[model samples]
Target: MFQVALTGLLTGLALIIAVGAQNAFLLRQGIRGEQVLPIVLTCLLSDVVAITAGVFGLGIVLERWPSVLPVAQVLGGVYLIAFGVHAAMRAWRPGTLDAGDGTAMTTGRAIMLTLALTWLNPHFYLDAVLMLGTVANSFGADRWWFLAGTLVASVLWFFGLGFGARLLRGIFARPTAWRVLDSGIAVVMGTLGVGLLAH
Candidate 1:
């Protein structure tokens, strides 16, 4: 059990460390100090749902659904790539700062968008559901330990990201900082999309 817990913890944390669309958006909101908590909470909760689904046998089901998986991957990848390109373009030609005051990034729609961006991604499902599920199932009755570890990692990661990015709030006050961030997000999204397509 101890070993299983440790393994699950390490795997979960390592996977979350990747700079995906979800993480990028979280950082964006964090820098603006807008809707950070709700966004983070939604992210963590969605992970909980995904991981729990995995532990309870959703992974096996997903693995069998070959057609669905590829479709999801393509759709999610296209959306991410498009969104990234738009963000990059916006960064290159940013409008006035006052426009940000009424930006949609702080609304419920933004929260839902981020949640969908994370949860709807097939890569996320593959990692949290299929991969983690396979690991938990390996332990049989001890799968509970793996689930607990994963849950802990999810909670820790969301809080850390949500709060840690806050440290850069002042730096983000400058318009150029947002541009840099958008460009970085564009790169990460495009790379991930291409990688998914190749796979």
Candidate 2:
């Protein structure tokens, strides 16, 4: 069981460590030090739901209804492209991501955007629901332990990312850094969007 749990932790880390829509957005919020707690909690809870569902039975349902993934792909792809464009615009005119009252990137808006980035990505479902679920189910009697391991990984990651990003505050103090970050985000989002659409 311990070995299985370790495997789960490592595997979970492997999957979540990848740079994707959720991570990108979370990283930006983490750096800006704006609404970090709610955003981190949201990401963790969302992962909990997805991973638990996958470990239980959602993976099976997704497999049986293959059509669902394609639909998700189209939707996710479009959203990613739009987000990429938004990021590009920000990069072109990088500024402080003010967290002041009545600002554009309000807490509520940030949370909603985070939710969209999480759920709208087909890869999120594939990795959490289908892939992780399949692997956890393989653990048979120790599947729950694996679930525990994955949850732990998620906790460590979100908390670390949400808080740890402040370490880079020195570099990001300049608008140029923000511009570069946003530019990279734009490219990532646009490339992912195009890939999903082509798929």
Candidate 3:
């Protein structure tokens, strides 16, 4: 059980610790100190649900229903491109990175965006559902322990990222830093969007 749990934890971290739309948005919110708790909770809950679904056999459903993937791919690609464009605009004219900069997002809007970022990405489904599910199933009877480990990993990661981002507040105090960050986000999102479309 310990070995299976460790494997799940490490695998979960490996899949999640990547530069992507979800991480970028979370980091931005954390740095701005805007609805950080809600955002983090939303991410954590979403991951738990996704991971649970995968471990319980959503991956098999996905495999049997081939059309679902292409539909998700198209939707995810379009949404990512639109988001990337918005990020690019922000990069071009970054405002103050402070919470009181008159650019703070409303909690409702922030939550909606968080949901979109979490759900609309096909990669999220691939990683959280298909890949993780397949891997967890490989452990046979101990798969539940593996799933629990993944849940732990997800909890740690979202909390760490959402809270730890405050440490970078000093650097992000400058508009230039925001510009650079947004620009990087734009590139990553755009590239992923295009990749999904190409597939």
Best by TM-score: 2
List candidate 3 segments past 4 Å from native. Answer: 96-103
Looking at candidate 3, what is the lDDT of residue 193?
Answer: 87
TM-score of each: 0.90, 0.95, 0.94
lDDT by residue (tens digit), candidate 1, 67-179:
77887788778878887887788688755321254355657877777876886588899899999988888899999898888888888888898878879877777888778
Deviation of model 3 at 109, angstroms = 1.6
Quality of model 3 by C-alpha lDDT: 0.87
Where is model 3 poorest over a 10-residue stretch in terms of lDDT? Answer: 94-103
Model 1 regions more than 4 Å off: 96-106
What is the C-alpha lDDT profile of model 2 across 1-199, one tens digit per residue?
8999999999999999988988898888888887888889989999999999999989999999989999999999999999999999988876543322324467788789889899989999999999999999999989999999999999999999989988987788788888898899999999999999999
Q: Please provide, for model 3 over 60-153, each residue's C-alpha lDDT reduced to its tens digit, 9 standing for 90 to 100.
A: 9988986888888888888888999998998887664344442468878888888988898888889999999999999999999999899899
lDDT of each: 0.81, 0.89, 0.87
Candidate 3 residue-wise lDDT at 124: 88
- Model 2: how far residue 178 lies from native, Å: 0.6
User: Ranking by TM-score, best first?
Assistant: 2, 3, 1
Clashes of each: 0, 0, 0
Top model number, lDDT? 2
